[model samples]
Target: MTAFVLVAGAYTGDWVWHDVAAQLRAAGAGAHAAVLTGMGSGAPAAPPGTDLERHVRELVELVDEIGDPEVVLVGHDYGIHPVLGAAGRRPGRITRVVHVDTPLVQDGATALALVPDPAVHQALAEGPAHLPPPASREAWQRWGSTDGLDDATLGRLIREAAPQPPATLTQPLRLTAAATELPLTGVLCIANGSSIATVQSLVELGDPRFQALADPRITYLELATGHWPMLSAPDGLAEVLLASAKGEGRRVTRPAEGELPPHLRPFLLDLPERRRERVGRVDLYPPEADGPRPAVLFVHGGPVPAGVEPTPRDWPTLVGYARYAAGLGVVGATLDHRLHDLSAYPRAAEDLAAAVDLVRADPRVDPDRIALWFLSAGGLLCAEWIAEPPPWLRCVAAAYPILAPLPNWGPFEPRFRPAAALGRAGNRPPIVLLRVGGERAEIASTVEAFLAAAEGTAADVEVIDLPGGTHGFETTDRSEDARRAVERTMRAVLDRLES
Candidate 1:
């Protein structure tokens, strides 16, 4: 029987781990998760003046009672400090310790004292009192992930926060356990991810934690959710940690060296980072199901760097493109490109070319069955990449493509007025350019310029003139046109492949 010991973080108590713990117990693991004093598990927190030495001790006492010399102890968030302290003191007791996106203390320290920020100290002073009232009773809910709690469990959450005793964080200890080699698992929770700046603000001292995990030996799992991994991705979280404990399945070896995980997320595609050196590191999306598939190199317009993994919002994602390619087998990917700004050019086009290189290099992506799915400014960049003509690319499908930016920059424009932004249309790629157009004459002019450039240049140009469609016709909040757009894009890409 694998004995389990669980601990909660911050104001949360054992309540958070109820779902996960039950599952572990059922798996024949002797699971025992306890509430910290002044925390959850039905214990009220100590007053601010509670003795640090006496209170922090409850952890060791609890472990000793568990009777298991070797236990898998889980320390979530602030709970890590006490759990590790107890683990270090009784090395024989803790077989393994799992930190779910918890902070790694530089010097063994407690939560409050380690904060190091006066703003936090001030916030702690005003503390839970000054916090805004939750919109509903569920506001006080202890979260493992958004998915962790159902209606019954959520209704039972305690409304008030436990008083944080600063002594826990201030007293640093030397971890004598040479067994520090005990496995550490990190859950990278990216959902509801605010800017990196915001993440740093909360765990300012956690910079070293990120640096340490670059080693492959450390078991790190990424759940495509938010900071509250247990809430949004409870199953994903449980699956990773519990699975890690059981033993990781043989990860099918891929040719590409792994990347900056959290920063990249899911945009990971199947390509060696070295091949597209100019593009730096990219996230490739491989086909999810077992089937040969038509492929597309997706380009999205963003001044900020796109992450490596696909986010939930990246709907009709790389995998979606692969899955929906007119029942034709399709593997797809999107790439991150460096950019100064939107109005800026040349840089975006350069990044698109790098994406093309990535697609061509991926073994699973049928080299000749690939297309370009570009939106808005991305369409402009795609047009530019086509000019260079990566050997593998076969077709292009652009959505609200930006062309002749100077002349036909808006809803109104004459159809043949030199395409406002066609300054260098002649230098573009010779592949087929499939444009989904609207009623706007500027789009017409843009199409005309693209057509004129391809007139005898061997670049096949096809236009789907959407009746009464506007610049952002199908991309709006899923109107009938949006449905049609998805269907049309799917049909067109498939037709190109099937033909």
Candidate 2:
């Protein structure tokens, strides 16, 4: 299907993306663009209660009219939901969404809502009336203007700019796709030339919320052009649009069903069931069919409050999600974990060891290829596993993991050491993240915030910004940044696993 656009933000219309649209067509994509209700590129202002329907209609109409197997959807500014709503209404028709510097408003939120800038949000509401306004001048001065555009181009943009409808600004979109799954990419364009780049949270897509999109699949990109890259860096913007259509923009690995254990399948897709009194659970996968492959028994990212065992879906990077595990073709499996109340330190590690014993009990799993993917508490548990180190677990991949609250891995990173790790050589060389005073920032809170505010201010070279938020948020919808952070870390893990 054709590439579609829903112009959002600043009471603008589809005309704004004209420069981008042209480049996309040149790049071999059939593209269509729509102006949302209330704001028009040239049309006079409309009446009240005009919702995002115009934008949605433009998208849906293009999809329906094309009759293609699937289409690539693009949204600029605040068009995320309008396009997403249209996509959700007809999920099968849209192959993927290109969130081109688009604010992904799911339910009633604008891109402006993400940052704490109310004044700009208000200006945005007044629609065309407020804009080309005094405030925008500063933003424009700082980030707008094309080095190559002439007076004619400038006059047309200034004259036709429409005020954004207050209704569109106020109406919260109900992100229907939250329940259904879809792939989306949010390109963070520092159009204003702001040193920092962002997607502006439908509040921060970090670990939790994004895990819904899963990793190695949902793409994220940042561009150097000012906000209206379409007007200035049209060529570059068009390149990105073409990449979106091709599905080769950003590649990620997801789990394939072939790697899953025969018994694990029903349990993975099934609802909570009576898990027999098993010591622990070990998950696995290999590269090819019926072949021995490297497997990981990721025993981390603690479980939720409701149950004793971790539902694969509950964890931030819910283990055994076929879409996720299939990536890298790594055999990704996790035990039905027991987190809070019914759990303690040694008990979990012992159970893990037994679980490994069980896997070793099977002929399919290559014990030599086993690795431990430990998160936070699980990291410490993995340290215990290494004390005597189970014969099965060959390597350890510790993520934002807590390896005995060392004096270093703390400030905000909890360092409480479990008694089980007492007197043990806790120097396990796992691929670790937030170890307090960490060399690299774990994609966790505090760290991500630090990165956000300290845009250029130099801090500790060892002090990195962890967008992933503290370890726990990795697999949950709680933090979108954390999800990307975890995915980045996953690549590293894959590299290490292969090495």
Candidate 3:
């Protein structure tokens, strides 16, 4: 019989897995909940020196005591650190490892480093050795969404929560190569804000960090509860865990090498290449008969992985658009911004601003007649320009752009919200938005929200809808409709530029 080792996240420990353990036992599986040091009811207070390694050692000891030949090690939230450490040390005993509502942390990474709130980081850096759990029911939301928890559960959670040792979070987790070789399963709690589709989208972006997710040995399952799925839906969680042990869940397949992802396919229009010049980080394609001509600067979407080769400036669609703009008697430009990840939006905005200044300073470009075109995730960058359009900025265009952050992004800055910015704007540039019918639901919702917000604004907004197109349709959808839409969009932007 397969044995299961259940681990709970911060604060409460063995008790958190009680219900799930019961269900697992009823289903003919041996379930053991390993309570980490400095946690669980009646557990002794941890010393300042009690770190992640100590907790990992505690879990390793439990596995040794259980002495099960086939062990399915399950980790939830903060518990993953110790679980991974133990698995790395005993790879021969662990058959499969399951991660519940936690990120895939790399070796040398600390739990505190993954925490999004800067205030939490500051407090942890300067505060006591032990961090107290939430004092009030409402405060629990900081850890994760409290969507499905009942009043009794919430009350009990706060009452029984233990102080988390600061060292446990700050200490790095070290893993051996054998741990990675074990089969893995990820359980995402959608109500707390993540789903299979979200993972697929990140993988689709060609982010190298997520490339391993496509391996057949890894599987994904979703629970429609909050972060504490064991409390909210214990039976459901048990079922998923059983299914995971059997290697039954959705698996994302990676495209073969030399095969293009939907987003990287060939551009719809095949335009002739123009004279290209590298202006610092920006690529420029000046029109043939140009003497200080109007310029269109294209910003490609992505918190693209920093190591992605060829860069956004060299992408086929961006190059195609730049060349197409040059054909329209305008100076075309494409730039590489530093939106390396979700947290680097401010830096990306700064990079884009610097690129804009560089483009305007060029002697061959008409600085006062510039248009900005944004794509995909780059749409968020449009918020600043739309909120306060400079006199030189004539028009703005976006192609299947994400105007708002997805729910999974978690507590993004309000300043990056283009929809909200549009609502508060006075005078703005003419906006040309290309909407794709078959766009991903998350991205499509943002586009709809942007349009809804635009309805209340005085800013001139025009939407060109492609009834049969998908996100990144310029390359993915090779239909004649997509080609016409691309042509129409280009013409519309050029008309505004020349106006």
Q: lDDT of each structure?
A: 0.51, 0.49, 0.86
For model 2, how does the per-residue alpha-carbon lDDT over 1-499 read when each residue is reduced to its tens digit?
4554535445456787777777767766666666445555554456655655655665566567775465777766566657777877778877787776544454655544442234555566556433342234333332232333455755565666665555454556556744136676656554232211112211122324423333444676556654556665778777766666566554333345455312123311222322222333544433333655556666754422333223543343544332244355656566755553223544555667676666555565565656666655465565454444444455655555534322112121122232233234243323334322222222223234423433343221122235434323333322445445555555655554566
Question: Each candidate's TM vs. the true structure?
Answer: 0.44, 0.44, 0.84
Model 3 residue runs over 4 Å out of place are 1-3, 12-31, 41-48, 64-69, 134-161, 189-211, 214-216, 223-239, 252-257, 260-264, 288-293, 362-366, 406-412, 437-461, 465-469
Candidate 3 structure quality by residue, lDDT tens digits, 1-499: 7789998888778898899999999999889988777887646679878999999888889898885668999998888989999999989889999999888878898988765545567678687878878777656776776667999999999988988898888999998888888999999887666778667767877788898778788999999878899999999999999999999899887767777776677777888868999978899999987489999999988888888877888888999999999998999999999999898999999999999999999998999999999999999999999988899999999999989876446567888999999976777899999998877665777899899888877668889999988767777767788988988998889899889
Error of 1 at 83 (Å): 1.6
lDDT of 1 by residue, 354-472 (tens): 66667667666666667777754455665444544444455667765655442202122232122222333444332433354442433445566666766656455565545545543
Positional deviation of 70 in candidate 3, in angstroms? 4.0
- Sort the candidates on lDDT, descending order: 3, 1, 2
lDDT of 3 at 33: 89
Query: Candidate 2's error at 487, in angstroms?
Result: 32
